[model samples]
Target chain A: MDLLPFFQQLEATTVGRVVRESLWMFPVIECVHLLALALLGGAVLLVDLRLLGFGLVNQPVDLLARKADPWLLAAWMVIIATGIPMFLSEATKCYYSPPFFYKIGLLVIASVYTFTYRRRVTRELAYGRAPLTACASLALWFGVGFAGRWIAFY
Target chain B: MNFSAFVQWLDATPGSVALRESMLGYPMIETMHVLTLCLFLGMIALVDLRLLGLGFQSIPVSEVAGRLLPIGLAGFVLMAVSGALLFYSGPIRAYGNIFFRIKMALIMLTGINALVFHYTIYKRVASWDRDPIPPLRARLAGLCSLVLWSAVVVCGRMQAYNWFEKAPGA
Candidate 1:
C-alpha cells in the first residue's frame, strides 16, 4: 500500500484544511488530545502500579485492572478521536517525522502488551511476573509519550 | 523590588537567559512538566473519583486516599520543580501571558479546594470510608476538584497558543 499519497490526500481533505487553517481548531483538538493523554496515563499507571504492588496494594490486581479498564478505554477513544484530526492536518509532516513513527510503533506495542501479557498476569494473580509486566508496560507507554513530544520538536 | 521589576530582573538573569536560549533546556523542562502531569493528576483524579463514589467502589475511601495521595504529592513536587524552571526560563513572558495568569489562579483555587477538603471533610473519612457514596460535602469537593483541575489543564494548554497575545493592539 502506498501510504504517502494517502497521507497527502488526507491532509488536503476539508477536515484537514479546516484544522490547519483555523487558528483555534488545531490547538483545541490538541488540548483534548493532551487531556486524554493524562487520563490514559492515569488509567494505565493505576493498574500497572497495582501490579507492581506500589499502588492500591490492598485491592486485588484484577479488581484494579477491571476498574481501570473503562477509563483506559475512554481515554484511548478520546485520544484517538482528537489525534486523527491533528494528524490529518499535518499528515505529511508526520509521515516524514521519525518521532511520529516511533510514537505509533510504541503505542501499538504498549496496547498489545497491555491487553495480552499484562491482562493474563493480572487475571491469574501471577505475582512472579507482575513486576516485569508492569515495568514493561510503563516503559513502552513512556516511550510513546516521549516520542509524541519529540514529534513536535522534530 | 516591585513585582514587575522582580519579574524583569528574574528574566534577565544569566541562568534564565541561558535556559531560555539553550537548544534543549526549555523543551526538556516542558516535557518533564507535561509528563509529570500524568502522574500528578492521574493519581489525584482517582482519589477524587473515589470520593465521588465513581470508581474504586470496592475499596474504602481512606485506603484509596492514603495510598494514592502520597504518590500524587510526590508527582506534584516534580511538576512544581519543572514548572518553576519553565517560569524561570521566561519570567516576563509567563508573567505577561493571560493564560499563564489564569492557570496560576486556577492552580491556587485547586490548592485551596484540596486543603479545605483535607482539613474538613477528609478529616472525617473514617465515618464514611466504606459508604461508596460519600456525604454531599465530600462529593461536592470531588466534583469541584475535577472541574477546576480540568479548567487548569485547559488553561495550561491554552498558554501555548497566542490567541490573546495576537490582539489587534497591545
Candidate 2:
C-alpha cells in the first residue's frame, strides 16, 4: 500500500497543523525530546556498559537493569510522546525522507532487542554473549539517534 | 585582543570557514555532540540521582561514583572535543547567542558545584558513602548539579532556534 496519501492526510489533522504552524512549538517539543533522549541514553548506556564488563563491576547485571528500568521506561514514554507530534507535523516529509524510515526501523529493532534478547541475556548472565549484545545494543540505539538527526538534513 | 574581536578572528579562520561551509562537517560534529550527551549527561544524572537518594539506593555511593566516574569522564572528553569543534565552527554566532551565554554560565556553575562537593562534603565520603541518603551538603550538591546541567541542556538546545536574533528588516 502507498502510505504517502495517509501521511499527507495525517499532516492535515489539527494537531499536525498546530505544531507545524507555530514557530516555537516544534523547537519546544524538540527540547523535550532531547531531554528524554538523554535519560533514555543514560539508562541504556549503564546497562550496556555493565553487560560489557566495563563499569558497575560489582553490581549484578539484573539488579542494575532493574534499577535503570524505571528511568528507561519513563524516558521512552516521553520520547515516544514527543516524537509522535514531531512525526505528525511533518508526516509527508518523513514519508519521503530515507533517514526517517531508517530511524523508525532502528528504533523498532532496538526496542525489541533491548527488552527481549538483551534483558534475557542479562538475566541469564550470559557472559559469553554479553559483549556482542552490548555492542549491538549501542550500535542499534545510536543508529536510531543518528538517523533521527539526519532526517532534518535529508 | 578584545573577546568579540577574538571571536571574529576565530570565525574568520580558514578552518572555521571550512567547517561551516562543509556539507558534512558541521552536521557530523553536531550529531556527535548530541549523541554523546546521552553518555555524558546520562552517567552524571545517575550519579546525581544516587547522591540525592532518588535511585540506586542499594549500592554504596562510593562504588556508584567510582565505577561510573570513568565512563562519565570518557563521555565528558568526547562532549568537550565535539563541543569545541562546534564552537570553532561558528565562534561569532555562538558569542552573540543569548542561550549560549546562559549555557556557558550554567556549565561554569556546575563545575564550581562539583568542585565544592568534592573538596568539602565528598572528601568525607567514608562517613556517608554507605548511607542511601547522603548528607545535606552532598544532597544539595546533587540537586544543584541536576538543576544546572538541565538548564545547560535547555540553553544548549535553545541556542539553535535563533529566537533572540532580530527579525530581518525590523
List residue ranges in candidate 2 displaced over 4 A: A126-129
- Docking tier of model 1: it is medium
Clashing pairs in 1: none
Summarize candidate 1's per-residue lDDT along A3-85 as a digit string, tens digits. 89989999999999999999899888888888888889898889888777787887777878888888888998998899889
My TM-score estimates for the predictions, one after another, are 0.96, 0.97
i-RMS, every candidate?
1.0, 0.8
List fnat, each candidate.
0.64, 0.85
Candidate 2 chain B superposition, TM-score: 0.97
lDDT against the true structure, per candidate, is: 0.88, 0.92
Displacement of residue A12 (Cα, Å) in model 2 is 1.6
The best candidate in terms of lDDT: 2
Chain A TM per candidate, in order of listing: 0.93, 0.95
Q: Write the per-residue lDDT of candidate 2 for residues A63-139, one digit (tens) a residue.
A: 88888989999999999999999999999999999999999999999999988998888777733337898999999
